[model samples]
Target: MVSISRRTFVTATVAALAAPARGARAQEGSPRAGGRLSFVIQPEPTTLVCFNTTEGPAIQASTKVVEGLLTYDFELNPKPQLATAWSVSEDGLQYRFELRRNVKWHDGQPFRAADVVYSIGLLKSAHPRGRTTFANLLEAGAVDEHTVVLKLSKPAPYLLYALAAGESPIVPRHIYDGKGDPLQNPNNRAPIGTGPFVFKEWVLGNYVGYVRNPNYWDSPKPYLDALLVRVIPDGAARAVAFETGELDLGGSTPVSPLDLERFRSLPHLGQETRGYEYSPTLYGLEFNLDHPILKSPQVRKAIAHAVDPAVVLNVAWYGLGERTVSIVSPTLKRFYNAKVPTYSYDPKAAAKLLDEAGFPLRGRWRFALTHDFQPFGENFKRSGEALKSALAAVGIDVTVRGQDFPSYLKRVYTDRDYDFTFHPFTNMFDPTVGLQRFFTSDNYRKGVAFTNASHYSNPEVDQLFAQIAVESDATRRRALIDRFQEVVADELPVLPLMLSKPVTVYNRRVVGHTIDSAGVQGNFAEVWLRG
Candidate 1:
């Protein structure tokens, strides 16, 4: 999306996009260790555990308390967190991790290799991404108290990059072992992990507070005495809080894009476009194929013609988006196929297609449908409004609906109530880990939040994804990925709108906030205050 090639893509893109905000490093002083660091989380999280859902707000809050087996450096290479060291077999079937000892859960229980084994099992069954990321795993066995080996049925090329805390968090086994559903476990709201921060309290519709863990294995880090994850649903209020110095940090373009330039003008503030490489995103419209009216390919293509990607990029994203037509995000240069079929905005062509599909206009209206926007941010709401306007011109009466994050998930993934919804999804480090879940036939779980809500199933697409997962050869993998994108583009399950280059706005008093690629989703161990 930022004109990054495979050579300088993952971490190198940071410097490529860092030209505008060179002052991001202007604050130079000894790191202070005792002030509270407050940040913002929009549309408060439904749960604080990333083991079940891939909800953005939940991952941002939970990673501060819960950690994974490994964390990544700025260059997207694996580094130690809970696991001190790791090795892989020559055949690429077995992965052995040497766990860090003397690490204890927040509840004062010892963190053992059994926790890693248990958490891996839970993620395989529960986590939306893990369901595919760990599908090749045969078992996670504890060799000793500090060693756990992952035996896979086949080689997974992207397994190492998929273990970041936000993607696959390691939950405490003692707290979740015999617990009643992991998804319904009370610990989800109040989690227990061995990270540098300890969960303190969560006041619904208000804030979730965390204090420094003095007993953290990574000692003297997470220099803040306390951390506050403030939940301010109003964008204007968030902007005011930042300007007045009430809020210290915010990520994923927390405020409206219109206010980004004004925030940059404030000498006390700085903006960052780095550290989001771990979670490059794509925003678009996803449809429910189960709906009878949408069951026809002609109808789906007609609706696609009525939509405009440029409108979504300008009106909804405020020119902060790169228009894309492929289901896979262009930021992932290795697998993104630019030659995929694209839909052009043509109202005349849309009307003809709808008429041929047995939806002749009746008194100036061909049909009516409900549109839902992902409630995490305001940008999606604006995109839905734009879609309503475009579809109306083609004789389609549309009603845009608004709801909270949890309710939106239940309606779209479980109830399958809507005709189509506009939202954004993170196409993580690899397509097999992120893009496969949206198109693969096996990933169409009804109750899952981020799975295939579209229920799009193609035998050829499924087989191509299966082959791409285990194929380690560079040339062969690219060819397989190209075919997968071509088939999915022709099916038109979802209309790709744009790719996001999200910015993180923070106060100059905050230091080391962009030290890693995960951005705010990363643990704040290295983040310290300049005061």
Candidate 2:
């Protein structure tokens, strides 16, 4: 195993800090303080609350209204947001944070350390990504009005990164504490947060609006008086809105590949492939091990061999994606494992494997299974159809079910009702942030949302994740993560198809639209429109 020296890690961190800063553009003159910015959001979230759902739309919408203890810069480096500064124990078991004083929630309630404690507790229990990311958090308590401390059972080196990823948005204890099942709280429709924007209104399937937070911690920020997020589901319509100056910004993947070149020719438009820096997402087909046919590793391997990711990239993604075998994307410099087992496009091999696994096509099709296409983007349906057609050639019949964001989450994450699903597993900043939960057996709760949907449990893989979590040494941690990927590749729990690049389009009149590596979830506090 190759060791990642401390120097290398420091260099990476330094390099990240050295990246281009995000804020008002220098050429755009002084930062003006007032204008409404209209933008396009493709997926219409079921709820305005981000913590209740893992839908990308919900999270992106909530980002403007809610603020976390920390957030990432353009280069994916952790920086202060709600919390001004922080310190960690030498052993990495305890964390101390200094909360920003004089901050008030959108409802005028003073922000306090108790809110931090309550928010952390809520994340540990209710939030999907937070459940695994903050699993080691033994206790979190407020030391004083402006101070909070977190006690972990074991070392969690990536905890800060997880907190900064926008998954665990801090909510007010007064509003959410006594609410029956915080997930179902009505306040989710109109959240009260301490961020730069105040939730003004939400019209389902139409639009969600936000006005400037007058009492925001940072004065004179959120230059725009209001932000109007239009739900334009059709890619062409969104592109047209952007082109016609009807929308100041087009949210992630708002402009389809077919329309990208045309938009590039327009001088008033700007394109970005940044903002997904922290989340190196892997798009793939996740198998449900609970199913009898899919329980066989050979069948899973055959399915992997049947589908050609290159073809999917061309037809569905328009060659905008990179083929991947490992669950982690190659962009994650430190933890990516390039040597994992890869499956080539070979239908003959897939058929032979199916025959050996007892599902031989003597006269009729070997078996039929249902697949759910996760509503990540419009192209998911095309990708699902491609996979279904590919598997048909191997005598495996598949029925593809396309669902909206809410229904898809309910069926796959809550009900666990399907045999296979096409979706992207994201937030892969570190092994602990995104990848660990999928492999750990303990995370496979029956009705829990965004746990182990695949129901895959390997003792060795679980042990490796546990070891990787507490291992403080950078070198040893990378080694353990490499081993974990090898186990995942061997088991074929999730056949990784491609790594997706999130695209964001905007009108050049909108200045200070900082495109961070965090992708579409970029901060809009400083964005101002030019007349």
* Candidate maximizing lDDT: 1
Model 2: per-residue Cα lDDT over 231-281, one tens digit each: 987777887788889988865668878788788799999887777767778
- Steric overlap count per candidate: 0, 9
* lDDT for each residue of candidate 1 in 1-531, tens digit (9 for 90 to 100): 122122321222222333221254344555678899999988789999888887789999999999988776555666667876676666667778878889999989999999999999999999877767998999999999999999999988788788889988999999988877888898998888898899999999999999999999877777889999999999999999999999999988889888997887799999988888777888877889998888888888998899988888898888887988787877677778999987799989999999999999899898999998877577888888899999999999989999998999999999999899986767888889878888889889898778889999999988998899987666999999999888877878887888898888999888878777788898888778875
Count backbone clashes in candidate 1.
Answer: 0
TM-score of each: 0.84, 0.85
Residue 56 CA error for candidate 2 (Å)? 2.2
TM-score of 2: 0.85
Model 1 spans > 4 angstroms off? 1-30, 101-111, 174-191, 202-205, 290-299, 302-305, 345-370, 374-378, 392-417, 445-449
* Weakest lDDT window of 10 consecutive positions for candidate 2: 2-11
